[model samples]
Target chain A: MVERTVRIGSTHGLHARPAKLFTQAAAASGAAVTIQKAGGAPVNAASILAVIAQGIDHGDDVTIVVDGGDESAVLDQLVELLSTDHDE
Target chain B: MMEIKGTGIGQGVAVGPVVRMAEALPEPVDRPSHLDPEREGERARASLSVVAAELANRGAKAGGAAKDVLEAQAMMAEDPSLIDEVTKLLATGKTAERAVYESFAAYRDLLAGMGGYMGERAADLDDISQRVIAHLLKLPAPGVPNPGHPFVLVARDLAPADTATLDLDQVLGLVTVDGGPTSHTAILAREKSIVAIVGATDAASLADGDTVVVACR
Candidate 1:
């Protein structure tokens, strides 16, 4: 498994639209991915409900773990997603 | 000649027959399943898949912002995390309908607990739960009604998924009993330029087929 920690960038945090974009990308990657707040239990990253329920606010640090299916590439893409402000 | 007051969205005065949207389905009973775990799991999966596909199709047809809202709802229907919960419940011999209900309710409560915009999202989960449960039970899914003509819609509140697919021409106006001006129903009404009055809790007493005048300032 490969993991990267990044701060959420959306101005309003991981709400529906941003959460949907992130979860859709994660599900499309065909990789086992999980996301969690720093020191929080990881949840399936492909679940929009789980992601939104985390209440990940802007600048909140989160760790995403990816296993199999081009781990490095998927991690890079998702990391970029987290670092960019989607609400802009 | 009842005077129902609420915050209006967009603007217009429309007069038409009232078409009441169905109430949300009752919570499923948590009874043990007579079918095997595998069979119950299959039933749950089938309903979820069907609901997901239907949402996706409606999203495609909807286009614009409605498309995004519907697409997100579709994702919720087949969310792998939710499926895992359903599967676990089935393993415990729960009926497919009850399993789906409890699983979605868990997330619903979590999101609602966040309050504000997140709390609004709880309605989306509720809509999906109703669709899946309706499918499992072979019942009509409660949502925007198609009464075969233009009408003023009345409901507790409109879910985004319902608003996304609303036939504007067919729905002359909207009166919701349980939504504030910032609710998804109001937002969509503004986006689509539909006349709407939200948070008119008194509107609940309005009966179907009652001709009412809806005027938005």
Candidate 2:
């Protein structure tokens, strides 16, 4: 299991569009991905409900875990996405 | 001539022509040969500031936690990158309306594409609604009066973003192009005793402004 930690650069946190965007990238990678806040139980990366329920606020540190083939590429793209400011 | 029903989020009864405040549709313009990049950039900044100010005012006035979402949208609207994009479009000789439209279109498409992405993984209505609302926020404001007109508001559905900005003084009734009794607009209208109907595709074709009486009952 490869784990990557990234900070959400979006101003509104993971409540709306940014959450949707992150979930999309996770789905596209087609890996068994789980995202969780620090000290929180990870949930399915593909489920919007599970994600929003996580209540991730802006600037929170989240650890994304990808367990599948080519996890490196998926992690790289996701890392890039999370680190970039998507306040738009 | 049917009086369909819906939930009224706000209170009030309106009877006017059906003035459609759909997406702002602007015609594309030819590119200018002599460009003033600096001036155009300032203009973009100025226009976006106006939109941002309105968004901020609305966000502050929003009545619930959803207000946070509106505030976020205001921030996005004021983003430097968007201003840059608008400025570039105008410098390319596009009209103000054209630049604004194209910039908003790009955000809309991005949000919609993201919605498509989430829709594939989650089929729940709430999930879909959130994504759709996010996309709507990315677009320029779709200012629909809450009471709309005394006429019925005809739409695909009353998106949360659309519902958020609705003025309670203009709507009399509603006829949606799509949606059902369980939809947000229906539930709210019903609660407020506002008449609303859904699932009528012809609602979009109605040309009446605030003067025509729409009986969706």
Candidate 3:
């Protein structure tokens, strides 16, 4: 599995809209992905419910894991999604 | 049959049946658990995990904006910090029901006490807590009703979770007895272009299936 840590950039954190956008991207990547808040248990990245439940706020560090299906490219794409402020 | 006046959200108008959102359940009594602390803790964990999984499943089916809200709610159901709180209460010999109730209440109070954005989160916490408690007791989760027909939702107020999952195509309008124009309910109505009347104190008397007209002058 390939992994990367990135800070949440949305001012409101990973609330409804941002979480939806991120989870949709992860699911569409056609790769297995998991995300965990810093020092938190990992949850399925494609599951919007699981991602929002983490209550990840802005400035929080989260680790993203991507396994299979062009891991590096998918990881970079997810990392960019995490770092962008979708709330704005 | 009577016209009630209040602040209307957005310019749209609608007419339909009224469906009331269920009220929050009363707090669980601080009673000792008949079961062993270990057993009660296990029960609490099982309920929490079940509710979490259920929320995730609902989110998966919902998609769009509703998908995100449901997903977040699922996370809240099994939140590590929240689970920690439940475990601590159960260790003290509290019943699983009370443990879940108190744990969620603690976080709800904390967030409500913070005000602003955090204050808004308190409602979400309340919704999750209710769902977990309902699961433990085998009761229907308290939320917007699906009467199988288009209706106007009347409630004391709408929580973020309730509003997020509302079926817009079926909801002709919204009316709340409490909450201001800036409340989450109003904002959602405005965003979705749904007709809404908020802070209608007299709306408290509105009953289920009561026909009402929502209009703005």
TM-score of chain B of each: 0.97, 0.60, 0.89
DockQ-derived CAPRI band for the predicted complex in model 3: incorrect
Highest TM-score: which candidate? 1
Q: B92-185 in candidate 1: lDDT tens per residue?
A: 9999999999999998998899997788788789889999999999998878899999999999998877888889889999999988878889
After TM-score superposition, the amount by which residue B20's alpha carbon in candidate 2 deviates from its true location, in angstroms, is: 3.8
Q: After superposition, how far is residue A46 of candidate 1 from its true place, in Å?
A: 1.4
Model 2 agreement with the true structure over A1-88: per-residue lDDT tens digits: 7998999888867766676577767867879888989889988776544575566777899999999968999988887877777777
Error of 2 at B39 (Å): 1.4
- Which regions of candidate 1 deviate over 4 angstroms? none
Docking class of 1: high
lDDT of 3 by residue, A15-51 (tens): 6677767877787889889999987899888865456
Best by lDDT: 1
For candidate 1 chain B, the 10 contiguous residues with the lowest summed lDDT are: B116-125
Q: Which 10 consecutive residues of model 3 chain B have the lowest summed lDDT?
A: B61-70
**Tens digit of lDDT per residue, candidate 3, span B83-126?**
77788888888999999888888777876776666667678788
Residue B212 lDDT in candidate 3? 91
DockQ list for all candidates: 0.83, 0.07, 0.16
Best first by DockQ, ranked: 1, 3, 2
Q: Against the true structure, what is model 3's DockQ?
A: 0.16
Q: Give the winner by DockQ: 2 or 3.
A: 3
Say which candidate scores most in DockQ: 1
